[model samples]
Target: MSTQIITAKWIVTGTSRDGDIQMLDDAAIAFDDGVILAVGPRAQVITAYPDAKVTPHPLHLIMPGLINAHHHVGLTPLQLGAPDSPLELWFAARLAIRKVDPYLDTLYSAFEMISSGVTTVQHIQGWAMGDLEAVVGSASSVMDAYADIGMRASYSYGVREQNRFVYEDDAAFCDRLPPETAKKMAAHLHRLTMPFNDFLTLFDRLTDTKTSPRARVQLAPANLHWMSDDGLLALQEKSVAAGVPMHMHLLETAYQKEYAARRTGTTAVRHLEKLGLLGPHMTLGHGVWMTEEDIEICAGTGTCICHNCSSNLRLRSGTLPLMPLLDRGMTVGMGIDEAGINDDRDMLQELRMVLNLHRVPGMDPAEVPSAGDVLRMATEHGARTTPFGPRIGRLDPGCRMDAVVLDYDSATYPYQDTDIAPMVALIHRAKSKDVHSVLIEGDVVYHDGRFTRVDRDAVLARIAEALAKPRDADELNRHALREAVFPTVRAFYDGYLQTTADRDPFYKGSSRH
Candidate 1:
């Protein structure tokens, strides 16, 4: 590979020194053979490598490419004209959408992510259509799309053995449905269900055959409510044997808290501890309802949590106790989680939102999220949760050459101070349109409003053609079944909560949990 130097007006190295973001003003970065060679003063770099080709961005800010710690393929629910609902009901509505080709669906979101400065995404798959062969094929399509687009991705299929929908015996809920609706629901479940062991086997097979430097396959148990004890234990064992990272959604709602209390006689975090599932390798998604004790356990176990701030607010899952989580020294990362405040995969804007959302009415300067903290969470902390190895997110020497360049000349100047830190100003004001270029593995995948590897317009057109028929027979059937079963599912939870309201601490919301 040819050696190259990129001189930028500012380079936010995405590393901290003495609790501050390390910045190099008027610096140049050199890369060769998909690895960073140097990052320092432009004059020194020029003197050091006189023969290297130079690409100068006199009015730009270069930084490590953002990592979206949690994401899913396909269109956003808001785009489908579906309003936000609680996660339990939202799952049913989300399943009512038409299925498109996995490759196109993955590309559709990748385009959004790359354009918005996201270089790596943890793409969690929940689709289990047809047999094992078909499922594996769909997963391969996702991997192929990311590979072709030159985006780094970590992939996992969401798996559960029981309680596919509500937090109870799905069969018992089916018994309340009319025979026809019950049969339709059962068929739908069968279409989307695979044995838990088969999921583990599929993970092994995918990793063995579809290996790539940019793509990783890992284990994910959907959530605490969805998986049985045996299935969770089996997943833990498999994850340990494979030595890959695990991701799961935990306590994203009050309903989940109630369910955990009733089923395990404790909180979800404690239950996972009892199952021996909380550890450095496991990353819990959302974590919106963790109590003080739960936080203590997570902190003790060295578990990481990916905070999806906009997703929680949009779905009314309540705000994650981010300040508390940070205070407890638990590792935290940022994820768009299928949608952000703008209902798109815009990581820069997502960083801004995270900074603004966690401010707790205090006069102390340290009470709110600093720009460096939020940016690190999006870059470094997010990368730590993926299977991308150690040197993935930072922009230092020997790290993978993944970066984003924003045009500081356009909407990013005048007030950007050299004496004072520029991260705070950039985080609050930067927009996705300001992204001028994106590179992964020393390759310029997106530059000057175009993707180097794929035809963006062509893939988008194909996606539109693929999803032209909005509602298929299967989706229509699932909708009818959801309509019949969701009421009972809602009522069961309401009654359970009502009966246990006085006894259960989870029912009381303002308890600093």
Candidate 2:
């Protein structure tokens, strides 16, 4: 295999020991055939491999590419008129948006991720629509987009067997609504129903493929409240039988915690354990409401958590007890759910947000997550939630050569600090514009403000044109129905909460409190 050596002014190898990242100055890395061959001081590597082609960067910081552990369809709910409301009502707003081609939608987000130094993503496909063939085609479109862009992705469509909306049955919810409004709601929501056999069959067909190094298919049972006991078990069975990872949303909202108590008379985590669904192969997304007992269960079972800091905050969901989770040595990954504070899919900014969000009001230095911890969460630990795991997170020998090059001129040039840690500086200052290039498997897919593989401008223009079209009759009706159901859904949660005197012990109300 032909060899290439890339030398940078600073290389932050995301290999942690004890509690610090292993970093090198004036470092050079050699790779061949998409695998890292060696990483060390510049002079030694250059001297050892004199014949390897050398690419020198005198002002760059090289680090592992970021990983998005929990993601969904690229289109942000907020952009689609879903305001900053409770997640339950937010769901209604999302249902009101116009439909776009899945391929274009996936590619649109991939472009943002690639430009912002993200090399991998876990796309939790929520619910597949249309007939069986159409459903499979939609999934294929998403996977094909990832392959075309050369970004590694773990894709799974979440299955919901019951409770599509509200905590009760569909007929009951419809019965409560006015006849005309009920008609619209049922017509829109009823199509979500699909046989369990059909769901698994589609997943099986999508996963049965000649595996690409860039993509893998997994299984997801939408959420703890959305699935029946039988549905969860069937998902567990299928995940085990197919030998793929399982990722599900667990306790994302306070209402969900209530649902767990009301339905199963216990915490959702314990309920999953009872159903034999908690295991090393499972990853729980947005575990913002997990209690101490739930944490213990997760720690014991080796189930992982993906920290989507931006999503939790945006949806007004409580923050995950990140420090405690890290202290227990539970694996946690970072993600920018739908959008970040800037309403964009920028991982670099998300990294900074993750660092700041968890630093509670305490003088204990240990309470704050350091830059290394944040980096690992965005890279190696994040990999655990997907099929990639340790293979693509580090820059050590034998690992896949997935990395990002930051122009130090843009990140830390005018007043370079030799005393401050590289990652600390990066967390505070780095932005997507600082990304010089992003590489996956040693191929430079994004370089110097341009994507090497696809016509970015054309793709973006097509997305704009598609979204700009007038809403169809169904889309228009969805908007009307969402408004009609929004208040009822809010009332449902209010009444449900009144049934119990339990208050969220973890989340202190916002400053307004």
Candidate 3:
């Protein structure tokens, strides 16, 4: 590709040495062949690359693209007929979800993500109802969607060696059901089963055959309850040997904490530590139920965490100790897991939620998240959790030219304050509609309310057409099974926590009830 210069009224480059966001006024970024060439004042950049074609966005603010550090599905569970419930029970309710074409389903979310300034996503795919080959096909479709849309994705097929539904073995849990119900559940488990070795094979195959330069394969150990000791060790070993990071779900709910304690006689983080999996290569998702000691262990080991703020609230999982995690100097990333609070993948909205949610009643300014901190979490810190690393997160020399240009006028319309920083104003006021352009690898994938590569309206129409067809026999059977198992799944978690203290809220509310 030929050289091009994109000049904006303001440019917020990556963070500085002191952990503050680096902003430049009337700045320009010159890039060629998907790599950033220079980023500085417009005059300086123009002088450096004098012959480059320029595209000026005088009314826009350009910044590093946001990263969704944790993501699962495209059409969310809510869209797939699964209502919000507690995390444990939500798994059972999710069984009723009708299967959609993976490619179309993935594109459905990719459109939402790119429009909302999310250029890279950590897609933790799981729950494919077939053997190893079918799972691989599903994964390929997911990755293909990202590649076709010109977006970056770090994909991992979540490894679930045990505990597919609740925090119990499949056979053991099935045995607890009625005779007929047990038979169907057993057959369902059998269809989803794959040899442990096949997981490694899947990882190796994906790593070797990645179709897009913008896509990379990583490892996910699903969750603590979902993994056996041997499975966790094997994944850890594979992670180290492959030199790719592993993202695992840990301590998302109170019951998960109890399950970990019951299983290992220790916290989940401690168990991972014992297995030599606590390191920079591992990222724990949610971490809402992590103790102070757990936070310290993660901090000491440089393990990352992805705070799925919206998912926690929607699933009633509990609010994360974000302030404590920040105070400990932990590298935390932001994610719109499943969907944001608005039932869509809007990173800007999620950023504001994270920024305001942790503000305690006290008037301590240092305790709450700053605009810079939230920006870092969405950009630099989020990039650290993915296999894409530093390449796609920031607009700097040698980094890929992935960025979002927001219409400053639109974001700060009808009123204004010159005293407030641009990043602060955008975080608090900007919506996905204010996103004017999104560039990935120097290609303008989305610009002026249109995608360059794909016809979004046509794609959505195709999806609607596909879902309009009658549910197949398998789909109908799964729906019936989900209804039958829902009550039993709910009953299994009755008094699951050992003590009243465990059931009490982790967050101390400001109200004097």
Return the top candidate by TM-score: 3
lDDT of 3 by residue, 236-255 (tens): 88988999999999999899
TM-score of each: 0.94, 0.96, 0.98
lDDT of 2: 0.85
- The backbone clash count of each candidate, in order, is 0, 0, 0
Tens digit of lDDT per residue, candidate 1, span 81-116?
466887777876665666678898889899999999
Check candidate 1 and list the clashing pairs: none
| TM-score, structure 1 vs. true | 0.94
Q: Tell me which residue pairs clash in candidate 3.
A: none
Looking at model 3, residue 346 earns an lDDT score of 92
Displacement of residue 355 (Cα, Å) in model 1 is 0.4
TM-score of 2: 0.96
